[model samples]
Target: MITNDTMQASSQGAQKVILTIAAAIILFATFENKMPGGMIGALGAMAIIGFVLNYIGDRTPIISQFFGGGAIVVIFGSSYLFHKGIFPTETADQITTFMKSGGFLAFYVASLVTGSIFGMSTQTLKKAALKYIPVILGSAAVACLLTGLVGMLVGKSFYDAVMLIALPIMGGGMGAGAVPLVQIMSGKTGMDAQTLMSQMVPALAIGNAIAIVMAGLLNKLGQVMPSLTGNGELIRGATAEVESEEKEAAVDLKMLAIGALLAISMFFFGTLLSMVIPMHPYALMIISIALIKVSGLMPKAFEQAAHAWYKFVVGNLTPALLVGIGVAYTNLDQIIAALTPMYFVLVFVTVLGAVIGAGLIGRMMGFYPIEAAITGGLCMANMGGTGDVAVLAASRRMKLMPFAQISSRIGGAFMLILATLVVQAIA
Candidate 1:
């Protein structure tokens, strides 16, 4: 004589029991080093660990409110775990290899970039494109100015402050931003690349950490001052158009497969183009997608399919991706070593300046201040792709992936060029 509500409760309880049992088994296998090799074991371990940390982070009082909730927890928690030898060596190695050689991050980003760009209305894309670069430039300029002035005040040279500290902080990430700048500066100044790297690495690490925290703070600011943010939207007055474009459709298994294929194909084409273009594949992919969207060449159904695929990946894999990032990219030691009071202040000001400058310029160009700051400012200040994911996830603004990519890839290229010019002038 059980009613429908009772039956539903019973069903839910049973599902929870089943899920708990599965998670327990995975944990046991992972700890015992008995898990299967390859993607199956790696993904299972990441999902279980990531989900548990995420749950705890989301409910942890002030952390859930001001910090990045589960996103930040997953990152720092996983890094701490890995650093402290809590995560099994085999398990750690597996996650690292999977993230890097396995190319999971790239795969995830490809889906996001393809789907997000396709999901937007051509009009919105065009409008945003025309205004986005200016915001990036404004952010970098202010960050450099602020950090340089602070350096001079602290008895450091303005050249070192701007070129070594501030420039690397806004250069994108380690590989694309700092590394290239180091090479360029070393070539111009006749300094060893290793020495240049030693200086730049700490700045990149500290800057990335500040950018993540700032993202969370900005998210909280948006909550407190609703007028400053469009929630996740970047451009203003385009909500109606974006909403219309984002209207969900019934997506079948075949359509999802099609969407996945399309995303991968776009990434593949971008990779192919990069060989000749001397630009990042991501930038090329974004440009190609934008052109396609603007030309009205892609069919409506395919666009819907791509968007569906993006939604699926974002909904299911984000926490796991964060775990991968934590284990693979975050260097707790580097961050710890760079925690001097003065050094920390410089990095903080650099990121803060980027946020403020980008937000102000973005507002002037019809963009939401918070959203603009997160994408153009914070993304530029972060460690590139991984940083973009971490910051965006922290801010709970995953829909802005396209713009974040632009900040990381296109904006990063601009920094490299600027670094080249500055190095030549100084030399």
Candidate 2:
């Protein structure tokens, strides 16, 4: 007896409730006792959730349509609530400072750059991505380990100082992965990290465009290359293929300026809210993103900007910063103890929920398989980046090029705000 509009309305309401709960949980964990070590437990949970979700995405092609990169942001917001909810408040100044500076701005840039660069010149990078994906990912793992070791070893900085670098690395790694690794090794300042991430928006937008181009090239290759066609229909074989169609980019300079102004405005409003509502500094960002999205002007902005400053930074940057800030001030060991035990259960289940739900929705709505896969890919990558996209792509056997590029930026501007609210709920 439920109508589609009613169902959608219910879904929206549920999202709001879920976000509030997650924020409450993250806040509670912060207050009850101190988190020690890294947010190892929570992060590990995120990793597993990330892995499982991508795996599901690859396997269930139809669902990918809706699950695309959006799922990634969605997963973190929800997970933060269920697992990290032992405490009830997130008003710790240390956590806020850690997040606001390092992770906050850095992630924004990383997603945007990755998206834009990939979006425009989809061709060249796909070749490079095919060649270097293995190395790139491995380098990423090694980079994470090395960064952690170096940070721990230099050990010269107190909690306050270490965070300046730590949060940036975490945010950057979560987005572009390897680039941030190099930046730190080169002795760049943390401010450099934020600037680098901001620049990443355009770079990746170009890269994403390239990815779209690559999908076309690969489609041609599919005509000549291998096929698993029992039906022998040639192009539309068993292999799941997703090619992004290029529309006129609604990219606009004016909209970019507006979105930026809105974000800054939200920052100020959030500051005001912090006094009365106890919101975090980045809360403004989340709220700003939501307002932009609900208003639905993002597409116009994208085309207006010529795909220049697309909104990758929102979901990814904000959460990475929030979690990074929390991690910066927090002791990893204690967090490991508090949250790790629940990792496997929480991570897997939530991912399963998204994959199953999004996939079903995509298929029921008659979306193509690859589209469904990209939809699910969002569960991990929207805020996180290549790690999430790569995992889903490989698992789904998708042409990572166009899907990765277009999918990341699709609904991108708004997802950031939605993701932040969800993450804040966890906090």
By TM-score, the best candidate is: 1
Clashes of 1: 0
The TM-score of candidate 1 is: 0.98
TM-score of 2: 0.28
Worst 10 residues of 2 by lDDT: 228-237
Query: Highest lDDT, which number?
Result: 1
Error of 2 at 191 (Å): 43
Count of clashes, each model? 0, 93
Q: Using Cα atoms with residue i matched to residue i, what is each candidate's TM-score against the true structure?
A: 0.98, 0.28
lDDT score for residue 338 of model 1 = 78
| C-alpha lDDT of all candidate models, in order | 0.91, 0.35
Q: Give one digit per residue, the lDDT tens place, for model 2 in 1-427.
A: 9899999999999998996676555434445544433444344333333343434543554344323332322233333433355433342333344344434333343334323332332232233223322222222233233334444445422322112222222232233332533254224333455554543333222222222222222233334443311111111222222123334455455755654554444456646766876433333333443344445555643433423443434332333432332233223333234343232222222223323333344434333323332333222222334333323322332223223332233223223333334334443
Query: Which whole-number lDDT from 0 to 100 does residue 408 have in model 2?
Result: 33
